[model samples]
Target: MARHEDRDPLNEEDLAQIADLPKVELHLHHEGAAPPAFIRGLAKEKSVNLSGVFREDGSYAYRDFVHFLSVYEAATQVLQTPRDYARLTTALLEECAANGVIYCETFLSPDFCGGGDLGAWREYLHAIREAADAAERDLGVTLRGVVTCIRHFGPEKSRPAARCAAETAGDWIVGFGMGGDENRGELNQFLYAFDMAREAGLKLTTHAGEWRGPSEVRSAVEDLRVARIGHGVRAIEDLALVDLLAETGVVLEVCPGSNVTLGVYPNLAKHPIAELRDRGVKVTVSTDDPPFFHTNMRREYFNLANAFQWDADVLRELTRNAADAAFCDDDTREKILKRLET
Candidate 1:
């Protein structure tokens, strides 16, 4: 496993110990998980150029957050068809299973899959759903989709995405969320979209307190009314906000490796995940986009253990927290928790 230079690195034996710890992942991106080699292959097939997306070592390359977003979208250019999405789904689930992620809810965008056309969205969803079903059967990794809208696309464009999400609320299409450039639009402007998803009975979450501050997270819960905050770790900056999050029981999908890799914090020791947890806030760990961040579920567990001196019990608590926060149905959640118990 690759380690960030400033942090104390884990050896092979340390990584091997956490390899089979069953986990639930709640904040992964569909397009972002595309293997670099897979994207390169698709770019070749479509005759598209992705020179800017890869590094000399054949891994993703980007200098900072804004450029990372550009590179992420650039990689998505290869995923132009429903079948393409199905292939991506299969590859992602296989990687998740290998990392001991039994249940994973990934953000899938209508804009990317079908360009906000409901009919086309259904076709793409069906392809991805079929792939997920096969993966659960063969790989033992249960998959769920959170239909997400790109926040940077603005409110007008977000409506079609919300409509698509609202129309597909079900066991497989479990939640609705917004994930993109968080700094682009005012949170209130997206309230109507969240309302649409809420009316359709979709669980809500949004990216906030990541590139921005605690006020961004505060507004997401207050105006947008999300049950979960993607990367709300920055809430640690405000003790009162931390208290409020604890009081309200809003879960934060904390992604440490992504934070440190993006320079959100200097290192895991400085990251706010442990502080947030200590403050009585509901916190669960996930690798926001594993490969892009150079992490997987096992690595996430290993790093947390090393940084916080967490034992097996602490790791299990995180798994249980994730299973509880999972967007799946009650029966599915029960089954997952039962697995964790065993």
Candidate 2:
């Protein structure tokens, strides 16, 4: 990690410039990014009770990581139809655009979309894509999906989700991944599902090493053979694994705010994102679940600048890293790179 004393501290103007830089976010959750007000309005219209889901001030509330999952699910209960998801895409993209995100790849779960049914998943996907298209035209932010299966749902459930991803593998749905409670299952258990997605030509990523240790990241790389690992900061605990990640050109979707909010690290200053980058690991910044963490792309950039004293050059490098790691096709990648240059 770059030490504070090793570089000149950024002034307020430099921080402002860093925050305004165009960003590419490779790790985001679809439902988890729902703004609290949107969810509240949906719940009101649907007559769903979301008593414990939000705090008095209207932010999502939870006692711990496990409880947060339950709260997240409760909040998502009202978004039952494809139309609801379309509205969500619009709201989320507006936020991303406000934060100067030019390109984003979000994790979309078949489980939440339609209970892992391919036919139903397709309906939900179409609605989302339509909204995404509008958002791209109106908000100047591009969106793509990575079909993700909840890890705690078990390997059997993941099969149907993977099948959905394979069936819909195309320009819009470009990747397949796993996200959920890391403690509940081993990475190797999802091997069959990953292989299925790979056969369909979808890129791969999996959440690992956030709650667990370096071995989990190793398993994600070796057993699952993922090109990216979400929140792989724990790999810093094992230097050899870190070196391996750098050598193999694997990307780490490091969500500093989420990690800090969830107590994965005490604070951003202590986070391993800079260290991972400095060690040659391909690290990128993102707000995994922005609303849940009370963060966005702008806040992430500003905090990282203060924590690491990273200037505009380093921040732009991270954006380039995210662009290189994005699962979009070449044409879209070229467009995003062009936007960044401006």
Candidate 3:
């Protein structure tokens, strides 16, 4: 086994070299990662009530993990029109493209798209997808959508979210999952939603092993049958679970920076990514909410290189993991992997 890896916690120059490697982000949230300046501008333009969502630096300010969600939603409330989402998507893809992201799958909640309704969801999805097309033309990054239900809102609301997902399943919206306050309920509560997406030919993924425990991961695997897991860092708690993940060939969308930022682990040193990788578990790196977590793909690579001593090869392999797990059709995935070869 390759024990002496390259992405350690000090190789800034090496980190710089790998920072430009083509990347595939599998866990970013559409609403949670808006630039603070963008949100503040929208709030002011609309005369909305957003008093203290920002720092004196005009960046986002949040007290804790839960508070982070409130600030995320507060920032989202100002985006009242399809144009807002379209512009946001355009700008976000530009930033992501700058960071060498060639392929991205971001979480899009119907509640935010249309507040749990079908017609409104279609309008919002169409506008944002148009922006995706424009962004692709300009930035050379393909953006795929994942319709996820906020789990904390309970299972009933998830039904409509899944319905919207089923209605929207096509070339752009290719997957579905769940991401919300982790303590909301058991994985079984959202099984129907996942099943719905899966039956609609959508690939599946779910946020597990974050605030919850390995039991949650177990439940997610057992009940949701997800193809990939979001965060999934907490699965380290059960050694058997780790082996099971490895054997099952399930991918873990690991976001080290997000975990540290949310206080899931004290720092990257304590992160379970290296261990999971060494154990043959396929773990890919991503920035779950880049700006909100004060990170980007470039910074995430730098941090991982510093923490895990990852070299360009390792970063390349991580990109492969993401590409392999991506919901893009096989032809697109092949194209992405070919581009990453450079």
Q: All candidates' lDDT scores?
A: 0.90, 0.94, 0.88
**Candidate 2 residue lDDT tens string, 1-342:** 454449897888888788789999999999989999999999999999999898999999999899988898888899999999999999999999999999999999999999888999999999999999999999999999999999989999999999999999999899999999999979899999999999999999999999999999999999999999999999999999999999999999999999999999998888988888888999999999999999999999988988988988889998999999999999999999999999
The clash count for each model shown is 0, 0, 13
Predicted model with the maximum TM-score: 2
RMSD of 2: 1.1
The worst-scoring run of ten residues by lDDT in candidate 2 lies at: 1-10
Which is superior by lDDT, 1 or 2?
A: 2
The alpha-carbon lDDT assigned to residue 321 of candidate 1 equals 86
Residue 263's lDDT in candidate 3:
92
**Residue 18 deviation, candidate 3, in Å?**
0.5
Instruction: Point out the worst 10-residue segment of candidate 3 by lDDT.
Output: 1-10
Off by over 4 Å in 2: 1-4
Runs off by more than 4 Å, candidate 3: 5-13
Tens digit per residue, CA lDDT, model 1, 162-272: 999999999899899999898898889988889999999999999999989999999988999999999998898899999999999899999999999999999999998
